[model samples]
Target: MIVGIDISKKWFDAAWQVDGQGRHQRFEYTDEDIGQLLAQTPEAAHYVMEATGTYHARLALRLHESGRRVSVVNPLVIKRFSQMQLSRVKSDRADAELIRRYGEQQPLSPWAPATDEVLELQQAHGWLNDLIGERTRLLNRREAHAHHAKPNAFVISQMAAQLQQLDGQIKTCERHLEVMVKKSFTELFERLLTIPSIGAKTAIELIIVTDGFRRFEDVKALCAYIGVSPTTFRSGSSVNGKGGIAKLGQGRMRQLLYLCSWTAKTCNPACRALYARLKALGKPPKVINVAIAHKLLRQAFAVATTNAPFSTEYA
Candidate 1:
């Protein structure tokens, strides 16, 4: 038996298949509703749902804890799968059916919830990012005021105070995050820090994004998840074009990797060589930078996996 669920903030639609027969239903976003739905499902039935942020987390966790097989798939993958169908109708029930069909047709890995420490790290990273963005906005506003002929002293003073507060908060968040990483993922964090151009901030961010290196199976999977892997674009002879990175994963992680790649290309011997070769071949800077980012991630993965510090000689 296979079950597919389309999750939303308030409710979820469900579709089930058994003995080549199909059924569809809807339920409220409550424990009672979930219990009622599960009553009809076999204990061994496989449940599939999309990763709809926090909306799906509680239900998925509950289902998993109840000894059900659960697969939380990426929304993009489900969307692409839906596009294959001939029917143009779109609704919650339809989506549930699509997800059910998708689960039936595709081989999907079961989902695993992150550990408490990893979840805490993810939240801390989000707070740090928010503080950084606030600081940037304040700085930009201050800069604009400085350029004005008749700047408002009061506004400028307020902006300065806000910036100072944000800076302090940012520092505190970083310190707390460092302590968490050291306590929960000490060896992995240390190994990542040993990589060229990977500082404490970048290493911590990588750890959080990779769920302390527990999410992906290999360097290639890591690259694809971070949107650093190149994606080919080709059809018949009439639609041939240059391929590029998919940019389908976490955008912030890709941006951070790009920034790190700039430093890696200059400081890391292996990355520098690759950068120079690509430049000599007249590859664009964007393409070269992405390649360097991919290389850096691969190195990070290797050192972390081996529980060893990064070594340039091996590179």
Candidate 2:
């Protein structure tokens, strides 16, 4: 029985028994509720739900423990899909139905959580990033006030001290995560470390972004998945080769890649040559920057996929 689940905190709605033989049935999300539902279900392959607000995770884990195949779709993909439905309506039932069709209509894969260390790194990294963003925003506002508002009234010195403290903490957290990564993935970390520009932080960030390198099938697909592929678009009779970074994948991954690009431009001969060649061909600085980022991802992907150190010989 294929199932589409609309997950919430206490209760969940399910588009039931998607054998295409019946309509839909809703159920509560509890041990008893799930146990009873499982009793009635004729063993199925896939159970699909959206990755809804960290709530779906527990239920999915429980379901998996009980020998059921459960998968969580990203909300963005599911919502974008909902727009295409001819009779699109906003309701729990509608959501469940969309999930049902998403399961039924497409070959959706199961959800798998990253390992504890990767999860820890992601949590720490995201928190530090948020803190940094908040600090930047506060600093920027204070500076703007000092320049444009009552200049004497706005004070920025104390906040600058706080910013320095936050920066130190963020760096400490990053170093700990990097150490954890080195312990967890010894071989991969060693290989990535050989690349002068691919540092511990960048490699660990890649692990989180790759979900421990599980989803990608190969390097080209990895590049596309990271949204580093230069896309193409056509309008009416005109074609433009101007589509840049897809900006659709993990932001953290893209950030690491950008940093890698900057580092490689200095430390990597191939990357330096490529960047120069593109500049010579009249590419915009931003375009060349993005291309450099893409190249770094490809190198990182190659290292991860092959479990080998990056070779300058590839250049």
Candidate 3:
């Protein structure tokens, strides 16, 4: 048996295939409703749903705890899958049916929740990201006001106070993150720092994004998830296009890797050699930077997997 669920903030639409017959139902987003649904599902049944942010977390967790197989797919994958259907109709019920069909027809890896420590780190990282974004917005507004012909004194004062408060909050979040990393991911944190150009912030981000490196199967999988993997376009003989990194994965992780690549190219020997060779071949700077970032990620993977610090001579 296979079950598919379409999740929303208030409720979820569920569909299932049983003995070659299809069934559908709607449930409120609550523990009681989830338990009721689970009670009727077969013990060996597989549950599938899209990764709809925090909305899907509770359901997935509950299903997992009940010993049911669950697959939380990416939303992009689901959207593309929907396009394959001939009907153009769109609704929650239709989406649930498609998801159920997707699970029945495709092979998917089972989903696993991260450890409590990693989850905490992820939450802390989210807080830090939000605070940083707020700070950037405030700074941009302050800059715009400063360039005015006659800046308002009151506005400037208000902005200053808000900026100061944000700065303090940001610092506190950073401290909390540091303490969490040290306590929960001490070895990985220290190991990542040993890599050239990787600092505390990058290490924390990597740990959070990779879920302590438990989310991916290997280095290439990690690169693909980070959107640093090169993608090639080819359609028959005439439609061939240039290869470039696919920007379909985590944007923030890619951005951070790109920034780290700038420093890695100069300090990391392997990266430096790769950069020199690419530059000699007249590759564009952006392409070269992405390549460097890819190399750095591979190195991080190697170090993390092997439980060893990065060493240029042995690398």
Candidate 4:
């Protein structure tokens, strides 16, 4: 048996098929409601739902704790599947049924909960990003205020105070994240740091995204998950398009990797060689940077899987 679920902020719709007929139900997110939903399905049933941010997290965890099999799929995958099936309806109930059909036919890996430390690290990382964004916005607003014909002293002072507070908070969050990584993932973090141009922030972001490098099996898989893999467009030799990244995965991670590539092209031996080679071929700056980022990921994965520090001599 396969059960499909569509989760929202306040409620969720669940659907399953029995004897070639469909059954559906909607329930609020309460312990009783969740238990009731579980009772309707068999113990061996496979549960599936899209990874809708925090909306599906708690329920998925709860279901897992009850020994139910759950597969949290990427929303993009489900959207593509819907399009292939010619699914025109967009209601929650329709989505639930579509997800049920998808699970019934598609192969899905069983979901596992991330470790407590990793979860905490992910939360801290997100908080730090939010703090940094706030700081940027405040700085821009303050600069705009300062350029006014008659800037208010009181307004400038308030902005300065808020900026100071935000700076302190950001530093505190970063410190917490560092401490957590050191305590829980000291060896992996230190190993990643040995790679040239892989700074503390980049190392931490890599750890958070890859779940300490346990989520992916190889460098290629990691690149694809981070959306840095090269993609090309050509159809029967009649239509040709410039090559570019797929850009289908973690946007934040891709941006961070691109920023790190600037330093990597200078210090990292392999990345530097690749950058120069691509530059001689007249590749654009952005293309070179992305290639360097991809090279860095390959190096990171090599050291991680080998359980050794990065060494150019052996590499």
Residues 155-208, model 2: lDDT tens digits: 566766777887888788777877777777778878877876887777777776
lDDT per residue (tens digit) for residues 134-245 in model 1: 8988888899889998999899889988988999999999999999999998889888888889888788888889887778888888988888888787898888888998
The most accurate candidate by lDDT is 4
Off by over 4 Å in 3: 234-242
Compared with the true structure, what per-residue lDDT tens digits does model 3 show for residues 48-157? 99999789999999999989899999998888888876648789999999999999888988998888888888888888889999999999999999999999999999
What's the true lDDT of residue 282 in model 2?
100
Indicate the worst ten consecutive residues by lDDT in candidate 1.
80-89
Candidate 4 stretches with Cα past 4 Å from truth are 143-149
Clashes in model 2: which pairs?
none
TM-score of each: 0.89, 0.88, 0.94, 0.94
Query: What's the ranking of the predictions by TM-score, best on top?
Result: 3, 4, 1, 2
| Candidate order (lDDT) | 4, 3, 1, 2
Q: How accurate is candidate 4 locally (lDDT)?
A: 0.91
Steric overlap count per candidate: 0, 0, 0, 0
Report per-prediction Cα RMSD to one decimal: 2.5, 2.6, 1.7, 1.8
State, as a TM-score between 0 and 1, how close model 3 is to the true structure.
0.94
* Weakest ten-residue segment in model 4 by summed lDDT: 248-257
The collision pairs in model 3 are: none
